[model samples]
Target: MVLISLGPLAGDVHLLNRACKGAGTHEDLLTEILIGRSNEEMFLLKEQYRRTHNKDLVQVVRGELSMKTERMFVMALTGTRDESTFVNHQQVQQDVETLYRAGPGKIGTDEIAICGILLQRSDAHLAAIAQAFPQRHRVSLTHMIESEFSGHMKDALLHVSRGAEQDGQGVYRDTQLLEAAMAGMGTKDERLCYRISRYHWNRPRFGAIKNQYQQLYRRSLRQRVEGETSGKYEKALVGIIEQN
Candidate 1:
C-alpha cells in the first residue's frame, strides 16, 4: 500500500467543524484520518483543514474530545518527527531519570507517558530503556509496575517496554540522518517528521518524549518543540540531537 503523507488532515477544522456542528463526532473523524491512510494523505488533509478553517484543526478536535480518545487523536495531530536518532536516545535517558525521580504515587502519569513515547522507537531503544530502568532507578521497571500499576495498564506497559535494544537500534542510521538533515541542499527546509511521526504513533517513544528533554540546544526537547510549526522554525532545529 502507498504510504500516506497527508499529515493529520482529518483532525483539522474543516472536517472538525463538520463534527462540531453535529455532522459527526470527533471519534468518527479520527478514524478516517488515522486509519488506512498514507502519510501524504494525512499531510494533505491537514492542509485542507487549514485552508478551510482559520483556526488550527487540532484545537477544534481537542476542544471536543475527552479521555483516552482525546489522547490518541491529539497525539496523531501534533506530528513532530524532525529529530535526531541520538537525540531520541538522549530523550530516553532523560525519561529514565524522570521515572527515577517521581515518587511511587506520582509514577503513573509519567510512567505511562514514557511507555507511550518508547513505543514509537525501535527495539534497540526499547531494550536500552528496559535495561536502564533498573540501573537508574534501583528497581526493575517490571517491579515498579507490579508495585504501582495494575491490571491492563500494567500489562500493556510491560509489553511495550519489554525490549528496547532491538527497537531504536537498527531502524535509522545516525550519520546518514545527520547528512540528510544538515549537509544537504535542503537543510534549511529539513524536517525529521518521520522520526517524530513514528514516535507519535509509537507508544513507548511517545512516553519517553513526554519527560525527556535533551535537545541540541541544551534544553528539554519537549520544551523546545512546538507542533505544526509556522515561524522561524526554532522548534525544529533546537531539539535535534547533536552529531558526535
Candidate 2:
C-alpha cells in the first residue's frame, strides 16, 4: 500500500473506506486507524467520512465488524469520551462501585459494564478511578483485573486501566502496549506496527513513548524489536521507532 501524505482526517477516512471494501474487511487496518485515534480526531474523521463517501463512518464500521471490535469502533466515533480533565471524585467512586459489582464483587465478570466505564472516561478520570478503587475494595483495580479476567479480555481491560495513567508528559500506556506485543512467544506484529504507526509522526509523543518503554523494560524499544525480529521487517520496525 502506498502511504501518501493526505491530511490526517482525510487519510484516515480513505484508509477506513479501503478497509471496508469487498470480500472481507482489512481488520488490522481498521483497528490500527480507529484504536490509535483520539476522541476528537475520531469525531472529525466521522464527519470527513460522511463528506467523502456519503455514508456514516459508524455504519461502515458496523457493517465491517462485529462483537467487541464493533463496539470499540462505535464508541470511539461517538466522541463522548473525555481526554484530559479534572477528576470527578463522586463519579469516580460510583464507577468504582460499578466496577466492583461487575467484576471481583460478582461471580462472573461484567465485561460490558467494566469496558463501558473504561472506554467512556478520559485517562485522567481513569487514574482517579484506579486510585479510588482500593478504598472501596480490598484489591487495586489492576489486581482485580489480573484476578478476575484471562486471555485477550484481560489484556484489553488492563490496557484501558493502564492507558489512563500518564506520568508527567510521558505515555506509560505505550510501554504496556509494547509489552503486550512482545509477550508470550511470537511478536504480535500488527499491534507493534499499529502502535509505532500511531505515534511515529508525533515526535514529542513518540519520544515520550520511547522513554517510558526504556524505563519499564530496561532496554530500548528498538533493541527489543531487533532481538525479536529480523530482515526488512526488523529494519522497518526500528526505523519507525527511531524516526522523528
Candidate 3:
C-alpha cells in the first residue's frame, strides 16, 4: 500500500514544486514524480498542485522545460495519453497498419506517427496492437521497430509496445532500463530514478523487475548501482530498489 504521510498526492505536488523551483530544471525529480504516476493519479496531482499553488501544473512545467521532454510532460499531465482498460479491436488493427506504414513500409520512420499512436494508447491497446500486428503483416511489432528505428526512440517504442505482461520481453525491458541508466561515461540519474520510483512501491512487480535485471545482466540491480555510483546517491538508489 502507498504510505500516507503527507499523503501521496501532496507529496507529489511538493516534488513538482522542487523540480520547478531551482536555477535549472530538475528533470530527474520531475521525471521521477511524473513518469511513474498513473494517468488518474497524475490528474489528481495536477488538481492538487493548482489547489495548493494556485497555478496549473502543465503551465508550470512548460515554463521550466522545452522541446520533446516538455511536450511529453505536458501530454502526461493533461492525461491525454492515458489508456482505457477496455480494448477496441478495430482500432487496434487500424493502429497496427498506421504503425506499419509509418515505419517499416515507408522509406523513413515517421517519428510523429510512431510516438503519437504508441505513446498515446493504453498498454492494453498496445498489447492488442502487438498481438494483431504479425497476423496482418507477417512480422512482430518488435521486429518492425528493430528494423526501422535506432537508439532511444527504438527503446521507448519497444518499451511502450511491450504491453503490461511480465513475460520474457518484459524482463528484457527491465534490463534495457538498467543498461540505459548505467550506459556511457556518466549515469543517467533521471532515467534511473524514473524507473525505480515508477515500480518500487509494488513489491511483486518490483521483484519481477529485479529478477529480470539479474537474469539478463548477471548482476543484481543493487550491485549495478553500487558499481556505477558512490556514497549517498548509490545508497539512495539501492534503498529504493530494496524497498518492499
Indicate which candidate wins on lDDT.
Answer: 2
* Candidate numbers sorted by TM-score from highest down: 2, 3, 1
Candidate 3 C-alpha lDDT tens digits along 87-151: 88989889989998998889887876777776677767777877888899998888888888765
lDDT of 1 at 173: 28
- Among these predicted structures, which one has the highest TM-score? 2
Clashing pairs in 3: none
The TM-score that candidate 1 achieves is: 0.34
How far out, in Å, is residue 231 in model 3?
4.0
Go through the candidates in order and give the clash count of each: 58, 0, 0
Superposed on all Cα atoms, model 2 deviates from the true structure by an RMSD in Å of 3.9
**Predicted structure 3: lDDT:** 0.72
Models sorted by lDDT, best on top: 2, 3, 1
lDDT of each: 0.47, 0.74, 0.72
Measured with C-alpha atoms, the lDDT of residue 226 in candidate 1 is: 42
Model 2 Cα lDDT, one tens digit per residue, 71-139: 766776687776767877888899999999998879888877887887788777787887788777867
